[model samples]
Target: MIKSCAVLGEQFVFRSLKEIMAKANEARSGDELARIAASSMKERMAAKQVLANLMLKEIREYPVLSPEQDDVSALIEEQVHEEIFKVIQNWTVADLREYVLEDQHEGADLLYIAKGLTSEMIAAVTKIMSNLDLIQAASKIEVKTTCQTTIGMKGVLASRAQPNHPSDNLAGMRASLYEALSYGIGDAVIGINPVIDTTENIYALLNETKSIIDEFQIPTQNCVLAHVTTQMRAIEKGASADLIFQSLAGTQAGNESFGISLSMLKEATALINEKGTAVGPHRWYFETGQGSELSAEAHYDIDQVTLEARCYGLARQFNPFLVNTVVGFIGPEYLYDSKQVTRAGLEDHFMGKMHGLPMGVDVCYTNHMNVDQNDMDNLSMLLGTAGVNFVIGVPMADDCMLNYQSLSYHDIATVRRILNQGPISIFKQWLEEYGIMENNRFTSKAGDPSIFMNGVLGGMK
Candidate 1:
């Protein structure tokens, strides 16, 4: 139809749907489907094949493209609602499971509950699909993985803070956190990797972090990226720790590197629960990447992606506040190059999200690898659309201390803009209030500092 916001308007949407259906049927392969769609729309992704095929399958019986029907809007809604209701009423869980298996994909039915299925439909939908199978299919859509993650958390588009200081010093920590806020990221949790392990440092770090929140007057929380035992000690010393962050591997030796065991993780969680109400409710942050298993020599010959997913399983047991796959942050030894690195990012993201862990991806890369902004750009878009919880928004996509390039604040902004999503909902309003954002959108001198300076040049002395 017409190029306007009308694309989102119900009537226009229906027209576009008809257009897509007609075009899709004329296409043959997935490539053809993409080409045909893009001839009118912009570039359609390969995934369009799955959707196109579904559309074609449904529309084949209606050889007539009649626009004569009165009240197309009601017709569209009724047809969609009826189809959904039929799926629930006509198929058993076993049948749905069989359909998924036979087709070998499309677990989107799992999101039926979220997509507007009524209570009556749900009551009849005892078996839309097996919970376990649905989770698996959600992960496998784009990534080769098995597991699930907590997709939505805190009633917001899940996000987080990652600040790594070379010295883990207070000043540097404050700077990183401030910079993160400048980009409008304060909703999730602020976590810092403390290079120094002393209780004094951890305790002081925690308090100063609390001060940062008070200074900014924001409803945010802080955490220290230290060993669980070290964090526990700091907590015992009265530090206001909000999250217990850990890195895990599937194998015993791999996990030992981080001094994390299932029992130990459980104990730490229980200890936090018993201590006090300083930290509200609960929090657990876990980091996993494809190369870590092989790096630890704990692969036991299993593939990195599979082992990485197993790490997701481990984190899920703790009810993770955040489970992120630092996609390419590990380096070249294990992931090889950007192609493999990019693929692993999607895999880890899918796996974490499958297990119901609040999932995000540290869309990043190491200098030693054959990668650049383009690699991360592509991966970030994939993650955004796949709805992987969140991403790390470090300065310049560079972690001076960690020695890797990560998603820049601009990367986050770009993805959020494309997805038409705002940062952690409440914080979005706060950002606008503080003028960091305008109208729920990030405001900035986006490209170069020089460009921003260009406007003010006339006033300069």
Candidate 2:
């Protein structure tokens, strides 16, 4: 079993990853590289990450090697890794950031990706920086986030209700919205992912969401997680898609796989502006994760975290209202387990915040990994203290539709209670009316069946 920091004792099963790295460093020739790479792919060992570790360690410790670099250099670049080697070979942190910022005439592409092809590069660069550096970077970027409860202000965190339903089921969605509001979440936004159909289905979901927001007079907006184009179509037909949701990557291939590109993002931005809503000038909600580029084969050999930052830069171009990194949702193939997940979660949060984005953490894990509740709880508290914009709110962090566990409403409440943070003012008022919350502390069972809960539950039958 690989031993990672977050998961220890009898529950851990991956063994000591440090030992594997020690073994992996022994590959000194092209033949060994080929052998290890092949073995790792064929399931002979889970130590494939050792290749990345070695490469990142070399880059972090040494300057650009001349043509007479060590044999491991050549071995590292053999075939499969050649793409990544070329991108990161001689690059430093500043160099990578410059590459991301250069204008089109200066060789910058429509998409400026500085991260996510490799995990090690980000790990390496971040390793060298202190917490003060990260804090300053975040402060320097300076993006403004606005929600109804804290209008005319910046630096607010909002909870979003991510409900996925088969088509537009009013009863089902009503319950989901009620669940979120009952817990004082979703002051930022309440959005849903339609299973298949985009236009009509999304239209229905948005309409229901709009109704909920209106009935409560809540200071929140609604969103449908459809493709930008599909959402554009819905808006053109008069559906209320107050927020645009999309998953972004650093590479063109990754964006294309998600049916989004830089040009498309621009068009969507313009389109949303044309079809204005109460949500105001800032209206893009983007979800980014590490390993998405590798998963989509679009990373072109870059580090995932840097790629994520580049993705943030792309979204920043349009002045996005929110961007969240589903840090551990991608599973163990990339993050390995909770230790890596914990590290990556903090890194992504730092990068996004550093780049002036309203960042939220989906401090979550998949069932297949070695992660446990302790890991999620720890990450939640850590991020909450860091002042993240929001976290995911599902029942027990378990999205039955998405088949992954994430930040539960209870988790959000626990963190909020501990930090003495309450939801946005209006949503907090609603919670107070329902007896669900009093003085920013979750009332638990003390919340009697108030008229608010009765009205919300009245339609549940």
Best by TM-score: 2
The TM-scores of all predictions, comma-separated, are 0.65, 0.70
Query: Could you give candidate 1's per-residue lDDT for residues 345-394 as a string of tens digits?
Result: 65565555544456778888888888898888988777666666667777
Q: What tens-digit string does per-residue lDDT give for candidate 2 at 1-461?
A: 22222212212122333233322221212213223212332221233333233443254343221214322122222312345455666655444444433343121131123222233343334433444443333323334465333321233446877765554577776776676776777877787867765687777777888887878776787888877788888888898667777887755567788887667787888877777475466878898887787777665444455456556555555667778888888787777677777767776776675445677778888898879889999877777656677788876678867778888776776777777776777676766665666676766633222434466532331
State the C-alpha lDDT per candidate: 0.55, 0.59
Model 2, position 108: C-alpha lDDT score: 18
Give lDDT: candidate 2, residue 111.
17
Off by over 4 Å in 1: 1-157, 276-280, 443-461
Superposed Cα RMSD, model 1: 16.0
